[model samples]
Target: MEVEKMLHMKGGNEDTSYSKNSLLQRKVISMTECIIKEAITDIYCATNCPKTIVMADLGCSSGPNTLLVSNAFINIINEISLKMGHESLEIQIYLNDLPGNDFNTIFLSLPKFVKNLRKDLCMSNPSPPSCYFNGLPGSFYKRLFPSKSIHFVHSSYSLMWLSQVPHIQETNKGNIYMSTTSPPSVIKAYHQQFKSDFSMFLKCRANEIVSGGRMVLTILGRRNEDPCSKECCYIWELLAMALNDMVIEGLIEEKKMDSFNIPQYTPCSKEVKDEVEKEGSFTINCLEVSEVNWDANTDNRLNLPDKNGGYNVAKCMRAVAEPLLASHFGESIIEEVFIRYRKIITERMSKEKTQFINVTVSMTRKA
Candidate 1:
């Protein structure tokens, strides 16, 4: 599959769009709020309160959460400048993602976003930083900015996606991701792909970020060393089961199921640290793992399988995966596939509680 052309969250603001269904991602962002502030704060301290700050949000998919982190950065820097009596600070942020991303939606929302930002800042300081926003469209696994140009970097829920699917000799039959049934070679192939992609990411960013700059990355990761751990791979497992059932019912072809594999890998925390060390461009400031419930929201209802919780989880998964699935399996089966997936999710949720493991890491570009 051509991952760069196909890999994007559902776009626009419709019911099925990523903009509406990205609450879980929003929650993850909220979880990392303090770290982002600290990273930005550290940048200010290390750089002796520079007059201009340049930052980029890598893989910044369009949605409510797309600008949430940027807003925080502006707010934090503004407050710090006020405290230090530094009145003339400038912030330049580049919002980046793949070319297929919904940059229009984000661009259209900026007027209201800036209006609210200025209104909020009016209370404390008469003037805010001269902030500028630009949309950068491309892959981040390669260089996207001029050397030593960026002062701070942030990426949320993106590094888990590999640049391309792992090339494996084994077929990984009946599974769309790493699974218990997958051969050991398939597991090794996925891990190697992640290592290569992440190393390239570090190398690219190392060139762009100035010495002593800070970066914070939030990734969907696993607690267990095993690649097929439930937290990381069960979501895809259930979807594969739904597809296999469709094939049996003659709704889709069996070969499509056998040939498909998600171009993503959820690494353990150790894997992340090892890659950072191997790349040798940044020093790890802090790395921690946190767990978020599969239905990371508050919808007080009966806890029955096939109920509200499962429906929400299904919608969230669809928001992120529907585009990729449609590109390969055909769009006609998408609605049906998720319908079945919702049922499976509810059934599984009823039996045992499951959570997504998130790895939040802060790093500094070594001087």
Candidate 2:
């Protein structure tokens, strides 16, 4: 489905924009805060204290969370510098995302971020470390920086998206992603895609990151080794059910549904570790999986009397998937589709809650 051109989150600050519906992603970031801190500390300890530190956040989609991790690293580095009596350190921070991402939102919000950063640093040190910020637009699957330029790299809730659909499966007629009903051929295609993409990712980073550089990645993944495990694919399964209902109602054509497939894959922990080991450039320092409820970020206490659990979930999904679906099915059917989606999720939640398995890994570039 030309993922590089169409797989971005909804842009702008509207109701369905990723900026408004990324609470779940923010929660994932919060959950991984300790890992991030530890990675930064390890970087400080392993590398010679260079006067300038360079860092990049891959897939820094537009939202509060875009800078959340970067801000944390800056603060941590500042504290470390002050304690080590190196207050003059400078930091260059790069925020990266796909070309189709809403970079303007992040650009507009940068002044305030810089202001707050300066204010926070001034509270302790009279002369705060200088931080330079730049926005890089491109795919991380390829090279994005000069060799040995980056000291740290971070990505969250991304990397699950493949560069493109692995292969078209006419046999998997009713599904848009991997599901229990999908054929073994479909599963094999997805695994091969991830293996190639992840290997390229590590190779590119190996050239860009300095020796002893660290990277911490947190992505939606599966705990079970099976690629079609329910925990990894149920969200798409419910989404497919919603689309099938639309097809029956004559709102969407069956042929169009047959052609659409989500360009995403959730790998198991073993798969991630295997790729890292095979890439021959990075050592896996730590790998852990955490579980989060599907509705972990939904704020039920909000005074919105009309919002139901299903509706909230629908909003979150719409914020991320609307662009991709609209590209395929046309925009006219989005609202109706999500209405049905909300109903499906609501009924399902009435019986049981669903959860996402999150994989967090820390690695260091080999000397």
Candidate 3:
């Protein structure tokens, strides 16, 4: 599958759109806000107070979270400026995602975001700085901005996606991602892919980010070194099982399933640190790993006393994975497949508590 073209969140304001089902991502962002603040503070302290600040949020998918994060940064910068006695700072904010993301929704919401931003700043003793927001659509695996132009870079729950599937994974049949049953070769392939992609990511950012600038990244990752750990990839394993059931029911072809692989990997902290050292462009300031329940953002309505948690999980998965799954398995079976997936996850949840391990890292460009 062409991952760049196929990998996008469900668009529009429909029930399955990413805007509706992105509560988990929102929770992740909220959890990492303090880390983000620290990174921005580091940048402010290390550099002279400049008249302009350029910042970018990579893989900023559409929805409330996009502007939500931007506003957070603006607030932080304003607060620091007030303490520092700086009069006016111009802020340039860049929102980046794949070319296929829903930029329209974000664009439409900007006026309201700015209006609220102005209102909030007026309520403060010192007025907030003027800010400009623009959408830059492309892959962050390559250059997305001019050299040394960005002051702060932030990415949440996005770096786990590999630039593309590993070439050696054709042998990884019956599985869409790394699992306990995957051979050593498949695991090695995933690790190598992450190393290559992350190295490039650091290289690109190293050029775009100014000296002393900081980057804060929050990604889905594993606690242990093993790539096949359940906490890292059990969700994909369950998804593969759902597809297998569809194949048995003559709903999807087995060959299609065999050929499809998710272009994502959850790297361990050691792996991430190793790549940063190898790339030789950034100094790691902090690295932390935290776990959140699989249904971290399930609403009360969905979390009724008797409701199955898998239903909410399935909905979240569909919002993000539907585009790719529909491309391969056909749109007709998207609903049926998720139905089966819900049952599988529900059964598993009843037996055990599944959680996703998130890794948050803070770094600064080498001087």
- Runs in model 3 deviating more than 4 A are 298-308
lDDT: the better of candidates 1 and 2: 1
TM-score of model 1 vs. true structure:
0.97
Where is the poorest 10-residue window by lDDT in model 2? 298-307
| Per-residue C-alpha lDDT of model 1 across residues 1-367, encoded as one tens digit per residue | 9999999999988998899989889889999999999999999878888889998999999988999999999999999988888877899999999998999999999999989988887778877798899999999999999999999999999999999999988999989999999999999999999999999999999999999999999999998988888889998999999999998999989888878999999988999999999899999999999987788675324433334888989999999999899999999999999999999988998888777999999999999
Top TM-score hit: 1
lDDT of 3 by residue, 158-234 (tens): 99998898887446778999988877888889888999999999999999999999999998998988789988889
For model 2, name the residue pairs that clash. none
Indicate the residue-level lDDT of 293 in model 1. Answer: 78
Candidate 2's error at 309, in angstroms?
A: 2.4
lDDT of 3: 0.87
| RMSD in Å for model 1 | 1.9
Output the better candidate (1/3) by TM-score.
1
- TM-score per candidate: 0.97, 0.96, 0.96
Better of 1 and 3 by lDDT: 1
Give per-model CA RMSD. 1.9, 2.4, 2.2
Query: How would you encode candidate 2's per-residue C-alpha lDDT over 1-367 as one tens digit per residue?
Result: 7888898889898887888888888888998888899999889878988889999999999988899988999999988888888868999999999999999999999999999999999998776789999999999999999999999999999999898898755557899998888888888898899999999999999999999999999879999998999999998999999999889899999999988888889998999999999889999999999976677544434522223667767888898899999999999999998988988988887776577899999999999
Candidate 1 collision pairs: none
